[model samples]
Target: MKLLMMAACAGLTLNTAAAQEMSYGHAEYLNSCAVCHGVDGTGDGPLRDLLIRRPADLTQLSERNGGTFPYSRVFATIDGRYAVPSHGNREMPVWGRLFLEDDAKNYGPSGGEVVTTERIHNLAGYIETLQH
Candidate 1:
């Protein structure tokens, strides 16, 4: 009985870890970015109607960049390190800040920067998968 309980707990831990890792970037994109970029990364999100400048069609990032995904640029853009002219004073939420806040809640305040960077990388990598 004890062995069975231990096995069950181990299974639960593995499942939870896998789910968290798999959903990390996708969840961030959906919660923060899909409002502008759309679930399909087509930039036709519901908020598009409210914006003066249309949200960029994220699927075309590679095409717009000579058929190569600009990974660093995308990461910087998300982290607010690279300013996007159309975004206007970075009105869109700075995800780095939000991630740091979230990390502080989960992992405490000391290593928030590392958490923020990992979040940016996860988000940027997810966007790369959206490229056409």
Candidate 2:
């Protein structure tokens, strides 16, 4: 029936959107966070032994935060707007600014902020999906 076909199409569209969104975040993570957090978000990255402080296991974030995903907190951390001691005296690059820089380079500066926000949110959403 038309109704069944419509529902199936809608589901496919949603799934495709979700897959694209997650793919963006996953790619960003691999490029940036995975060096310290590991590709699996296990805090056992190859560079872990070189860092002064151990990276937190991203998979345990929900467990540490009382069973709810700390969406805002993760966003802030990735955005690097506020100082976080855990990020080590701000030595690490702020991912938000980095994304903005890329956007500005590719699309000019008109809507860099929007792209930056999307990048951070997508990354945070992907991290949320990684929660155990």
Write the residue-wise lDDT of candidate 2 on 1-132 in tens digits.
999999999999999888786678898888889998999999998998988888889998999999999999899989986665765685456887788888888777878778888888888988998899
Reference-based lDDT, residue 94, model 2? 81
lDDT of 1 by residue, 19-95 (tens): 77766788779878998879999989899889877888889999999999999989888998546577667556677
- Using alpha carbons, what is the TM-score of model 2? 0.75
Query: Stretches of candidate 2 above 4 Å error?
Result: 1-22, 84-88
lDDT of 2: 0.86
Per-model root-mean-square deviation over C-alphas: 5.7, 7.2
**Winning candidate number (TM-score):** 2
Q: How many pairs of residues in model 2 come into backbone collision?
A: 0
